[model samples]
Target: MTRFDIPAPDAAAHAAALERLDALVKPVGALGRLEELAAWLCAASGQVPPPPIERPRVVVFAGDHGVSRLSAYPREVTAAMVRVFLAGKSGVNVLAREVGAGVRVLDIAVDDDLSDVPAEVRAWKVRRGSGSIEAEDALEPGEAARAFEAGRRVADAEVDDGADLLIPGDMGIGNTAVAAALVAAALGVPAEEVVGTGTGVDEAGRARKVAVVRAAVERAGERVSDPFELLTALGSACAAATAGFLVQGAVRGVPVVLDGVFSAAAAVVAAEIAPEAVRWWLAGHRSTEPSQAVALKALGLTPIVDLGLRLGEGSGAVQAIPTLRAARAIIADMGLLADLG
Candidate 1:
C-alpha cells in the first residue's frame, strides 16, 4: 500500500525542445526517433536541452522464483549470474562499460546464502526465494512492502550518487514465467500470448510455462486490479523492487530506461501505482518477448531500437545508451538554423 506522488514531466520544456529540434540545421523530423528522444529527455529533466548523460547506472535486481520448473535453466543460475555480474563478467557489464554506465546487482530474493557476498548487494534481501506463484503467493505478508521500500532506497542512493539515467534490470531463473503471469493478469491477456521462450525454453517448456502462467493469473483473479496485490500474488521480490525503483525514479525526477520483459512487467505495475511516472520512462529496446510488446503498447511507448534483443540484465538498455547520448548531443550541440544568418 505504498503510494508514490509522481509528477508528470515538464510540458513547456518538451515544447521548447521540439521547437529547438525544428530550428536545428537539419530537415524537420529528420532525426526521426532520436528527435523524439531528445524532446523526452528535455521534458523529463525540465531542461530545454537536457544536460549530457554523464552517469548512467544500471541496477540489476536478482532473485529466484519458486516456479523453477518453467525455465530451461535451474533456479541456482540466478545466484551464479549475480556473481558474474558482480565480477563484471556478465553481458550487462560489457555493454554498460561500452556505454559508460555502472552496474550494480542486488540479491533481492535469490534462494541462496549469499552471506559471503558484499554487504551492499545483499543489504536488501527480502527472502530466500518467492513462493511458487502457481500454488502460492509470491511474497509473504509485509514482504512486498519491504522489497518495494528497498527499491525506493536504491533509487535514492543511485540518484544521490549522480546517476543521470537509471536502467532497471532483472536476473532470476523462471522469472519470465513470473513476469508473463503478472502481465497476463494485469492486461487481461491469455497466457499463451504472454508466454515466450525465455532462457531458450523448448516448445514443450513454453507450453508448460503458458499453463503455469494461466493458473497463476487465474489464482490472482480480481487481485490483478490492485498493483501491490497483483505483485504479491504473481510477481517476485525482484519484480516488486523493480516497480518501486521505477516509480521512485519518477518521484525523484530522474529518467529511467526500461529493459526487457521483466522490467516492462514491473513498469505495468508501476504505471498502475503512478500513472504519471510513465512520462519519465523510455523503452530502451524492443525485447523479443511477446509480453514486453503488450506491456509497452499498454504504456504507449515506442522502443528506441529493435535489435531482436531478448537478453535481460539490462543489456538491451545499455545498448541504447549511446543512442540516448546522441539524442542529447543533437539537442545540446547542434547548430540552430537561425545562427546561419
Candidate 2:
C-alpha cells in the first residue's frame, strides 16, 4: 500500500509539560493527572514539550477479514455487534460517557454492506470486505491505502470536534492474523509470537490461525524488516489506516490510548514509521496472549490494566480510559497538604 505522510504534532506539548510542572502546586512528581495531562498536551501540540489533553476522543474501527470466514464464528456476527455498539448498548459507550469522551464508530470494511447505516455511524467502507486471504493478498494495495486515509479522516474530524485524546478500537472478524502479521513484521519475530486467541478461538482453531499466518508471510515474498512493506504484504485495511492515524495523531500532538493487540500492533508499525510516535502512545491493557507481552516489550510500554481480558473490540481500552482520567484528575485537582496552610 502507498504510504501517506501525516506529520507529527506541531504544538509544543513538551514545553506545555514543562510549564505545567512549573505551575503544579506541589513539588515535582506530586500531581499525577496534572503531570500526565501536561506531558500529553505538550507532546500532542508538537511543542518542544507536550501539553495536557482537554478533551479525549474514542473511535472504533470495524471490518471483516477473509481468514475468519472459515472460523467457528459467522461473518454476520461482526455487523450485528457493530449495530449493538452504535445503539449505545455496548460497554465502551458506558465508559466513554463517564469521562465525557465523545465516541464515534466507523465502518472501515465489513464482509457485508451496511447501506442503511444510521446517521450516528460513520462509514468509510473500503469494500464489502477483504478477499479470501488463503487465495489472495487479502487487500489490494489501493484498498489498504484507502483504509489509512479513512482513519486519518476520522482523526481529523475528532480534532475538529475538540477531542484531544484519540482512542481506537477494531471490530473486524479474523483481524488477529492481520495484527500478528504486522507485529511479526515490525519486530522481526515469527508470526507465532504475535498470534493470540482472539474472540474465543479454541486450541485447534488457534493452531490453524497460526498456520494460516505463517503461510501468509511465506506468500508475501519480502523481508519482514521493512514494517511498511511488510504491512502492505500482511496488513489489513483497518490496521493500515490505524497505523497512519497513530502517526498522524502523534504528529498532531494528540495522545492515543492503544486498546489491544490490533491497536498495539498498529502502534508497533507507527513506531517503525516514526520511532518517536510511541512516546505519545499509552498502552491500555494486556491482551489475550503472551505475544502481547512481546509486542509491548518491543514498544517499551506498560499496561495500566492487567485483567486477563482479550475480548478485542476496543472494550479493554475503553474500560481503562476512566483510570487514565482519574490519574489526570488526581494530579490536576487534588489539594496538596501545603495548600492547607
Candidate 3:
C-alpha cells in the first residue's frame, strides 16, 4: 500500500528548533507564519536550522472527470486549458516563474484522445479519462494503482531534478462533486457539508451537486466509511493523482503545498492512509468552494494564503510557492545577532 514517513518529531530536536528560532533577532511572536514555517521545517528535517531550498518543483496533474458528463462544462475545455498552461499564460505558470519552480503537467485522464503529448507535460494518459461515474465506478480497483504509479514516477523525477518541495495540482471540471463524495465518506460528515459550488456552479447548480453526492453516498452504503472505497466511488483521475502525489511525497519526505478544494480533498484521503502525510500538506489558500472551510478544518490545516479562490488548475498551490521561498530566505539571509551585535 502507498504511504508517508510519519514518525513523531524527536523531543530533543524540538527543543533545539525552538532555541534556533528564538535567536532569529525578533520578538518571539513577531514572525507569525514564518515562525511556523521554520518550526515545521525543523521538525520535518529533524534539525535545528533547516537548509535553504533550490530547484523547487510543482507537479500539475490534468485529468478528465466522469462527473463532467453531468455538468455544464464540456470536456474540450480541459485540453484547451492545458494549452494555456503550456503557453505559460495561466496563473500557476506565472507563479511558477516567480518562484523559480519547474512545472510538469501530468495527463492521467481526459474525455478525448490527446495525441502528441506536449513536451511540457508528463503524459501518463489513462484511457481517454474515466467513463461517467454516475453510472459506474470512476476507476477500476487496479487502474487506480496504475494512476498512482504515474504520480510516483512524477514525484521521483521532480526530486531528481533537485526539487526540495512538491506542489501538487489538479484540473478537472465537476471535480468538486468527486471531492464532496470523498469528504462525506472519508470524514463521516454529511454529503451536504462536503458539497460545494465548485468553480461558479450557482446556488441551484450547487443544490443539484449536493443531490448527486447524496445519491452517491446512499448508494455507497456501509463501505462509505472507508476513505479509499469512497474515493473509488466518486473521485476523478485528477483527484486520484493529487492523492497519489501526497502519498508519494510524504513517503519520500517532500513538503507539498496543497491548492484549494480538490487538492485538499486528496490530502484528506492521504492523511487517512498515512497520518504523517498531513504534516507534509500545507494549504495555500482557503478556496471559494463551500466545503473548503470544512475540509481544511477536518484535516487540522489552516491555509497560509486565504485568497478567496475557487479556480482549479493549482492557481492557489503555485501562488504559495513564493511564500515558502520567502520564509527560507529570511532565515538564511537575515543577519544573526552574533554577526551584527
Candidate 4:
C-alpha cells in the first residue's frame, strides 16, 4: 500500500476566520453556512480572511463498470461522454464555463480506446473497467492503489497549476450500483436502503441492482475492514481514484468540492482512510440518491444546495462555486461596524 501524509486542518486559522466573520457588520448569524464555509476555507488556506479563488478546476473522472451489464445505462455511454466532455459539450463543461472554472476530463478506465478523445485529457488507465462486484472483486490486485495514486497525482498537478479549488466528478455507467455497495460496506448499512434508480432504471432493474449490491457486500464480508480492501472489492476505478483525489486535496491543503452520490461515496472511503480530511471537504449539493445523504451524514457535511439534482458530471458542485465566491466577497468587501461608525 502506498503511504499518504495527510494532516489535519489548521485550527488557529479556523479560529481567526471565525473571529473576523463575527466582527463583520452583520447580525450574529445572518450568513449561516456561508460563515461556516468562510471559516473552513480559512482553515484550508491558513488565511484569516481567505484569499479570493481565481482558479477553480473540475476534474471529471470517467470510467466504465462491468456491473452496468446488470442494466443501469449503456456501458459504452461512459466513453461517449468522455468524448463529449473533451469537446466541451457536457453539463460539467457548461457549468464550469459559467463559473469561470476550467474542466479536465480524465480517463481512468472507460473500457474503450478513446482514440477520438483530445490529447489534453488526462489518461491513467488502471484497467478497461472494474469487474462485476456482484460476483467477484471489482478491481484486480494492486489496481486500487494505482487508482488512488493516479488521483493523488492529478490533485497535485491541479493544485500546482494554480487551482485554488477542486471538484471531483464521476462518469460511469452503473456507478450508482458500485457507489451503493461502497456506502453500505463503509457504513454497515443495508444495501436496500442505499440503492436507488440510477440514471433511468426501472423498478425491476433497481431491485436487481440492489440485490447485486447486497451480494457484493456479502462476498466482501470481513475484508472490508480497510478502506483499500473495501474499494478493491466493491468500488470502480473512477471511485477509487476519486477517493485519492479527496485524500490528496486534503494532503495538499486545498478545498475539495464534492459532486453528487459518486463523489460522496469516494468521500466515505476517504473519511475512513484519513478522518481529518473531512475538514477540507464541502458537499456541493444534496443529490436525490438515497446514499448521498447517508455518506454526507457520515462525513458530517451540509450541502450548499438541495435542488433535487442527481447529475453525476460535477454539475451540482459547479453550481455551488458561486456561493463560495460570494462568501469570500462578503468577508473581503463588507465593512466592519467599527469602521462604519
Best by TM-score: 1
Residue range 132-181, candidate 4, lDDT tens digits: 99789989988998999899999999999999999998999988888999
Candidate 4 residue spans exceeding 4 A from truth: 1-3, 119-122
Candidate 1 per-residue C-alpha lDDT over 236-319 given as tens digits, one digit per residue, 9 for 90 to 100? 899989998999999999999999999999999989988888988999999989999999999998888899988899999988
- Order of all candidates by lDDT, from best down to worst? 1, 4, 3, 2
lDDT of 3 at 34: 77
lDDT pick, better of 2 and 3: 3
Q: Estimate each model's TM-score.
A: 0.97, 0.83, 0.90, 0.96
- Show model 3 residue runs off by greater than 4 Å: 1-14, 69-72, 119-123, 335-341
lDDT per residue for candidate 3 within 273-295, as digits (tens), equals: 67777877788888877667777
lDDT at 269, model 4: 95
Worst 10 residues of 3 by lDDT: 1-10
Runs off by more than 4 Å, candidate 2: 1-54, 119-123, 223-228, 335-341
Query: After aligning candidate 4 to the native by TM-score, how far in Å is the CA of 197 from where it should be?
Result: 0.9
Cα lDDT for residue 241, model 1? 97
Model 4 poorest ten-residue lDDT run: 114-123
